[model samples]
Target: MPLPYFGLRARISLAVMLATLLATVSMAFAAYRLQADETRNRFELAARTSFESDLKQALYQIQYGPVTDPATALTAYMTREQGISWALLDFTSGGRPPDLWEGGYRVDAVVRRDDTPPVTLPEELVDYARRSYPEPVGKLDVDGYLVYFGAATDSLVLVEFYNMGGLNAELAKLRWSLAAIALVVSTAGVATALFAAKRIQRPVHAVATAARLLGEGELSTRVPVRGRDELADLAVSFNAMAGQVGHSISELQAKDRQQRRFIDDVAHDLRTPIAAMVAVVDSLDTADAEVRSRSARLLTAQTRRLARLVEDLLEMSRFDAGVADFRTEPVDLAALVTDALELSAPSADVELRVHGDVTLTGDPRRLHTVARNLLINAIGHGAEPITVTIDGSRPESVTLRVADSGPGIPDELLPLLFDRFVRGDRARQATEGSGLGLAIADQNARLHGAKIVAANDGGAVFTVTVPRGVTTTG
Candidate 1:
């Protein structure tokens, strides 16, 4: 799968954090290395200086050893600085121990002193002096110290060692301070990343959510433009696009409905005249044939139904074209229901009962159509005894309900009832009809600023609710 590109906020934030972290860590490491090198250099210098001082004093005193004290000089030198340790050795032998010295700090040694039994310092310190100062042999850094003694004279060589505790402590403090600074910098970077990320992602996220809603069939949802920035401009453009899409969809649907209604209307309207002409001709040409008379009657009956279908389709077209002029006036809904009941077949008596005195601001012709179509649909598809209830005293609106006691509309047809040319029975059989009655009714109702919905309550019920006194132009 391809990776989704997160908006600039995330990208910028990530870049900043990475750059900051890398720089901080790099600087931290550099600081540590520099400090360590300096500390090491300083420690080495101090140790060498102490050793040289001790050695110089020891050599001068050793030359006059028969009368001078070299121990005091060694003690005084070691006391002046913290990082040094020292020892002294007197050798009386004519030749130095060959195996006793190797480097700055000797590893093994023995000393021979006169008048005081043999006193030996650490052999390692002595070896360090001999190897480090190979040229003179008497001046060498052993045990981190410079040594001063003579081979010809019985002399004591002083070795000095430097203390590292204070230096180590100072290095540790520097390292911790650097670490703390790095931590602070890292925290600040994270905070800055969070703030910048939100600012950049919020508007993009809004657009994304709006797009999702549109995809899910909510054409009304739109991203609100909040700024003059690019994202805001994108949102404004999106809203405009959505509006155009909605308008286009509506126009296409209206055209499709008008075309279907036109076909149904032509078929119905032509059938009536054709049947009348056929009847007149058959009566004149075949008066003696009874079968011919019966055929004529059937044709006439079908023709009348067709004419009504065609008339309904034409009316629907007028509404779709925005030319169906509506007369806004107070209509006695009770009287209209009575007229509808009279128009329906008597066998549907129980299915079409009218009740209540509901008045609405609408065109009487269109409201009557709405009532007639709803009743016809109920009676034709439902079991007899449909109950028509009118409640005009609603706090916000008036409701006219026509419910049938027949089998409730199938779940599938409920949503499409107001669609053009859809009949409940035809839908069940996967068949088609002129399919304009309910659609025409819905359009007419909406034209009068009213709304209609379909449901089932022990039967299928179509509820037409009109906002009181509200009238809409065709």
Candidate 2:
């Protein structure tokens, strides 16, 4: 199977279990080899010590007691030992074997056959013993038996053969015991690894579940933090990010609803003027001269109102799309204000005042539009005695303030003054001019890195501040 198909817990458990099993098997195998070598060395040393002791006793009996034949004494000693068999060769008597000993003794039924006599030690072993006779004791293998050789006297050598089936059986038992122990240790290790994996996987599983819920638009979903670790920190961060995303989505949805309402209002405003022009179109052709002139004038006024509304809508769209173009130049603020006032030509009772002369870098045409809109709005809603003030005393910036003598703006309307299509009151809403005048002025000021703020000290005051050495053209 692919490794990814496994869960985190299973993968971690498998990794830990494999590591434990590998270490256990390595140590077990190493211990088994060490134990086998030690067991073999111990068995060999015990056998050699027994053979040397038996030979020394036989030599003492020959020197101090009434023992005439050393070969007979060693033969009697070998027959008395149950698991040991021996052979005595007399090299002093021209290589003749001793009496009462028939060839070699067989230690097992497999080596001793009824169909034939037991096989004796070959001549190779006898010659080896004679050639290396001066050595006191040594070990060799004759047929299937393990033999230990000891030189009892100058002319006599005693060779003892031991049964190896018992040593082999003991070693086999040790191997089986070690294998069983390793199996038990490996099983216990896997269980421990699984328990550890579960502890680690709990937090991870919670995070995955929360993430899945978030993808399905459940932004409030969060994982619980239990400890001061990286996983707990991850849970905290995820919850914080989810909250931010939910708030942003809520704000965007509110803006979308406001935009839809604005589009509906634009459609309603255009319908009124177009309907009025359509109703007066045929009246101009059917009436007398005087009546026809009135009809033509009325139609011309509605047509101009519709055209202005459409132009304002188009300009708002350009500003919203960040595509409004500009041409930068130095323009005199005092001259621009005077030209706007002459163009508007308000009633004679309204007073006009020019305070200071200031020259700044900006788009002249757009700045003129700003001044004209502020003047027209003040004249329409504000009282007479309008005062226009310019202050360029600051080295880095300039300000233009237009204040009128009237009741100040409503407290609720002040906050939303620059919003598109927002009028001060119901009476002002019915006046001539689209409601986008203040909004257009606000956008134009922003394009030049400026700000327009509305407040009331004596009456309504609109202040436009433009930064020095700035251009709107990009």
Candidate 3:
């Protein structure tokens, strides 16, 4: 079968099972070969030792004349050793001498055709024995029997053959037993591999399912952490990513809602001025001189208000599109504040305080706008004695604070203080100042790499902080 068609669990299980089978089969084959070699060596050694001992005794008896006939004594000795057959060749006269004695032992009596014996020495073995007189102790293979040869005297040779039929039968049985064992072990190994693979597959499947849900826009989907492993770490990282994605989606939705509200408010604000101008247009053409002058004044006021609102909206749009131009230069901040205060010309009843001085690199026009907005916002919403503080004590930055003595901004409005069209209250909405003042000031401050913060310390305080050597082009 193609590999990719298999699931992860099945693939893992197959791999483990194959490895186990290979190892088990290799080890079993090696062990069987080693045991077979050891058994063969042990049997050969024992047979050779017994044959040598019996040959030595027969040779001693022949040399000392214990029974007079050497051949007859050797034949009688061979009969007593079971599972061993022997043949004695007397080469005293030389040149293919007849074997004086042949096999009397029977390894398989029932399989034999006659009492003459089933095994007989081959000519090749006899020739080898005759040629190997100086080193007469050697082994030979006759059919399937293991034969050991030894020199009894200078011209007499003793050849003994051992039957290996029983050893062969035992080895065949062991081979079949090993085959059965391998089959059983392989089956068990496959089962164990499957069990282990299942344990690992569950968590992987959960992660896959969670990923699918996340792909389908379920940002809250998460995998349950099961253990302390790399998979668990992956699950944790996925959860963190999902949370970040959810938060980012929420933020985008909020911005979308805020944009809708801003458009609606802009439409409402524009309609008010347009309605007034439309009502006054007909009156100016047919009314008396006194009424015409009053209507004209009203028309001009509404036109100025409309123009201011359009300008503020355009500036805000430039800031939003990140395309506002900044023409920067070094300007004295104290002088800038003084100029803005003079331009505002607050009522004599309201006290004004100024302190400290600092020079900063920024666009004078934008900085003037920021100062004017902050001063106007303070004068319009706050009570008398508006204090403007210029703190440049630090070498790296400058601070311009506009504070007023009034019942500071409401707690709920502080967060939205810099938002466009946000007024202090319904009462403040009736005032002439456009609510875009603070929002514009905030955007301009950001353009100069500065930030404006609002807080209540005795009253509403708006602080503008510009970093040292700020680039205005940003």
Best-matching candidate per lDDT: 3
Superposed by TM-score, candidate 1 places the C-alpha of residue 179 at a distance from the truth, in angstroms, of: 46
Candidates in order, TM-scores: namely 0.45, 0.67, 0.79
Tell me the spans in candidate 1 whose CA falls farther than 4 Å from its real position.
Answer: 1-284, 351-357, 426-434
Model 2 agreement with the true structure over 372-464: per-residue lDDT tens digits: 888888878787788888888887777889888878788999888898888866535658767899999999998888878999989899999
lDDT by candidate, in order shown: 0.67, 0.76, 0.78
lDDT by residue (310-384, candidate 1, tens digit) is 687668667657888777788888788778778765556543334344776778888888888788777667766
Q: What C-alpha lDDT, on a 0 to 100 scale, does residue 350 get in candidate 1?
A: 47
- Top candidate by TM-score: 3
Off by over 4 Å in 2: 1-9, 19-93, 96-205, 215-217, 226-228, 326-366, 427-430, 469-474
Residue pairs with backbone atoms closer than 3 Å in model 2 (clashes): none
Clashing residue pair totals per candidate (backbone < 3 A): 29, 0, 1
Give the per-residue lDDT digits (tens) of candidate 3, residues 67-186: 766666666666666655666666665444554235322223222222323344455555565576434576766566776766666556677667777788888888888888888899
Candidate 1: lDDT of 122? 46
Number of the candidate with higher lDDT, 2 or 3: 3
